[model samples]
Target: MAILLAPMEGLLDFVLRDILTRVGGVDRCVSEFIRVSNTLLPDQVFIRVVPELLNGGRTFAGVPVAAQLLGSDPVCLAENAARLAALGPHGIDLNFGCPAKTVNRHGGGAALLDEPELLLAIVAAVRRAVPKTMPVSAKMRLGVHDDSRALECALALEGGGASELVVHARTRADAYRPPAYWERIADIRAVVNIPVVANGEIWNVQDALRCREESGCDSLMLGRGMVTNPGLALAIRAAMAGPDASPAPWGNVRPDSSLTTSPALYPIINWQVLLPFIAEFWRLVCARLDRRKQAGRLKQWLNFLRHHHPEAERAYMALRTLSEPAAIGQWLALQ
Candidate 1:
């Protein structure tokens, strides 16, 4: 069972990719979408977003990272994919799943879902540009405005020679709303020959299990869920591996109300264990990210963390108003 980390545009960059992979459970990570426009971007553009490229296209924890690109121009995307391929990312992932208006306004991202023919042409062009051995993958939502063309889009991608597809289980209109249509993935999976990795609304172990059962997808991708609970991938992995019968763990067996088939099989990453990673994250943010954005980054993570851990709730409260990196550092030191 492969557990891949979803490429979250703003929130899950290379920095968080480093810390989270170190926390363990994810087999691979897809870097955030690099927006491609009219011109062919420089090599630095790819490297900047996926710095793991400098480290042999893998995170500090040794998890392979795939560089994802978003664009409507098939030729431009293919040329950029060829350049990005030379960087040796684990794979190249195409994004047709982003729901942002800024993206769709330009006829990129989910906007492409309405045109399956273009999707086929785009994927096929990239497939031809890259080497045979390199894995070319695509991520897509159900549709732009609805699910009518979901299967057609999936088939177009597969026919274009995509090795695999990640379905985000929602329409562009659905945005980031809950109740991801995982069952819709099953429909797409039925029509397409490529491996379909399920994504969206997977916030906990229970959600993961039901998503797996309902979607019939062994490979799942974690996004906001993993951000909220860093140990989510580990927990899902443990749960899939089944229990040791020790009855010893967090959120203990007491999964969400919908599931009763599996015992509380996985162990959770407690607050104490997460501290070191948080510290390292802050250090990296200070050293690498812009000073103006540092405090916001930390609070962004803590805001998500607050949902999974009470201590994080307190931490978010403590850092909520503070924007200076120095002040944030002092507060982190005391924590």
Candidate 2:
């Protein structure tokens, strides 16, 4: 079974991709969505999103990476898709799963789900633009407001020549809520001959197994689960390999000295391992963003990590008080 790392915008950048791929089991990685507008993106924009292409379309550690495009215009997207394909990525992926209000308001991301014909036109245009040998895939939510429209969209994408589909198992309205409807993925799989990859709410090994069983999908895609627990992909890979494979130890690894215990005193130690990584992550993010935007981005990740790690709250509290990345780095250095 193929285990793919989902393309989560700011949270899953090159550094995270490098770290997760090095943990040893992901089949492939997708770069965060490149929002396409009027003109084709310059080579540098593609490089910023998929620097792996600089090293032969592979991550720093050599894991394959695909370039993902997000746009509402069929012709513009097709042009950019063709340009990105020339970069020699393993494949090209279309994004119809992002639920951010801004992206949706602009008629990109999951908003496209509302118009099956438009989605089909975009995918077909992109597929026709790329080389016949190159594979074009798509990732999408069940629908915009309800699962009522999922089948039509899935069928439209397949009919448009999508080689594979990754279903997030929730509508754009669900927005990361509980109960990711894996059964909906099965529904899509039943209608399409293309491979279906089940995504969303897969937080652990058992969840991965159950999702595959319930959805009857041959592969899985992971998002927030990978952020809270770095070794999750490794664990899932081990589980798929055989029952005899051992799961990686959780909450025992620490990248910061400030973390006092293997499992910190707080109740959510399992999630604390992510704090150091997040700190380092935003340090890199800060290089590209202004102060306020960087803080907002850091807080967004910390909020997600807080659900699983005790240190995350503490780190968030401490980090929130600092206005500069240097202070955050200093706090981490002391840790």
Candidate 3:
């Protein structure tokens, strides 16, 4: 029951990866996609995208991290993948599932699904460029608009020497919509002999179990579910480990001895654990963008957290009114 953390662009940064890896049950982490183009990427670009490699290709806590690349050009992507492999990461994952209009417009992400042969070329080029021992994998949606060509796409990747494949159970058109067609993933599993990881709509332990049952996949990848419930990986692990096994609640403190035993306590505790990470994230964003831009990014994450974690609302309100990081830290402390 391997659980790989999905590489969500803006949400899953180094800070969050560090936090989640320390929480137990996650088998591996994939860094957000590094967009490649015609130009050679600067070393700093690799450093920023996969800083974990600085400390042995693992998160600060030693969880293995893989570098993921996104691009449409075979030559450019292969060159970048070779350079990244030289950096000594645990693995290299290619992204062909992103649905962003800008990415697709450039023929980078899911847009490649429209040309399965090109996708195969890119994977083959990358596999040839990287070391034979270094694992090469890919993640993709069923297709650009339908699952009709999914088998062809999976077979193409497999034919190109991809060590494994992760199938997000929806077409690019479905984008994060309801009822992910796990059956489509099962279809892909049947056609490919390599490891197939089922991904999509897995928001809880039950969902994870049902996904594996329906997709007949031995592994799984989690994205938005982890954003809403940080403990989801642990829950899935406990469920898969044994029916009698129960995971300890978050916060590292016993529930009975917690300062507040209220049913709502978990959300608050989650916020406490998350605040420092969020603050660090804001600082990193500020270093790369303007203050207004950084605040907008922070607000966006807080809004997502608000849906499942009550403290997110309070934290968002307090941070929305403050421009300085110190003030935000103070407000978080007071919570």
Candidate 4:
């Protein structure tokens, strides 16, 4: 089974990607979307979203990174993708899955699901735009409003020559809600000749196993789940290879005390083990982002991390109202 990191627009930027990839287990990563519009974007624009482009298209930990493009215009996207190809990403992935209102309002992202013909055109154009050796993949939700055209959309991407397809298993209307339709992904994989990767609601080892079984897919993409628990991929592998084989200090899942916090279902990367990565992430966030945005970034990540680590909850509250970098650093150091 292959595990790829999902592209999250605002949350999973390069800083987090670098840190998470450093923690290990993810096979490949798809960078956050670079929206294409009327004009062909400059190389800097692509690099800005996927700085891994400058690092031989791999994270510092040596994980290959794919550049994902979002747009409604096939010609414009192809032209930009061709330019991005020159920069040497591991691959190019089209974003037909983002449910952001800002992106959908512009007729990009999930809105494209409503037009299967257009999805085919976009993928084909992008596939032809870059070198044939370059893999061009597409990520799509079930549909914009309903999943009625989910299979049609999957077939459209396959017909357009996408080497792989990732089905997020929910329509745009679902909008980050619970209960991803994993079985629907099985339906998609049945028709498409290319490999199908299942994504959505995969939060733990059990969830990952069930998603793979239900979707009939070998590849699973980790999104917010990975952000919440950086060790997820490794835990999934450990569970698959030998449920009892994981080393001490890892796979330290406590019993489930509440239905919402099913802590027993997943491994816990102790706060001590996770501190170095968090420090490095903060360093990168400071170096790459604006002064005003730095503190918010750390807090944002902690908000997710809190779900898995009680330490994160304490850290989040300690830094909740802080905007000063020095104060944030001091707080992190004490952790």
Q: TM-score for model 2?
A: 0.83
Candidate 2 per-residue C-alpha lDDT over 1-335 given as tens digits, one digit per residue, 9 for 90 to 100: 78898899878877677656654457788899999988978999999888888899986556789899999999999999998999999899999999999999999999999899998999999999999999999999999999998999999999999999999999999999989999989999989989999999999889999999999987899889977666676666665657554344444444322211122122222444455555556666677556776766677667766666767778778887677767766777776
Candidate 4 lDDT over residue span 1-335, tens digit each: 78899999889999898888777678899999999998989889999999999999988878899999999999999999999999999999999999989889999999999999999999999999999999999999999999999999999999999999999999999999999999999999999999999999999989999999999999999999999998888778767766545354443322211111122223446788788788888988889999989999999999999999988998999899999999999987876
lDDT of 4: 0.88
For every candidate in turn, the CA RMSD to the true structure comes to: 5.1, 5.3, 4.8, 5.4
State how far residue 114 of model 2 sits from its true place (Å): 3.0
Clashes of each: 1, 2, 0, 0
Question: How accurate locally, in lDDT, is each candidate?
Answer: 0.88, 0.81, 0.80, 0.88
Where model 2 places Cα greater than 4 Å from the true spot, the runs are 246-303
Superposed model 3: Cα runs more than 4 Å off: 246-298
Distance from true position, residue 229, model 4, in Å?
0.9
TM accuracy, model 3:
0.87
Estimate TM-scores for all models.
0.93, 0.83, 0.87, 0.93
**Candidate 3 local accuracy as lDDT?**
0.80
Give the distance in Å from residue 73's predicted Cα in candidate 2 to where it truly belongs: 2.0
Q: Where does the lowest 10-residue lDDT sum fall in candidate 1?
A: 252-261
lDDT of 3 at 60: 55
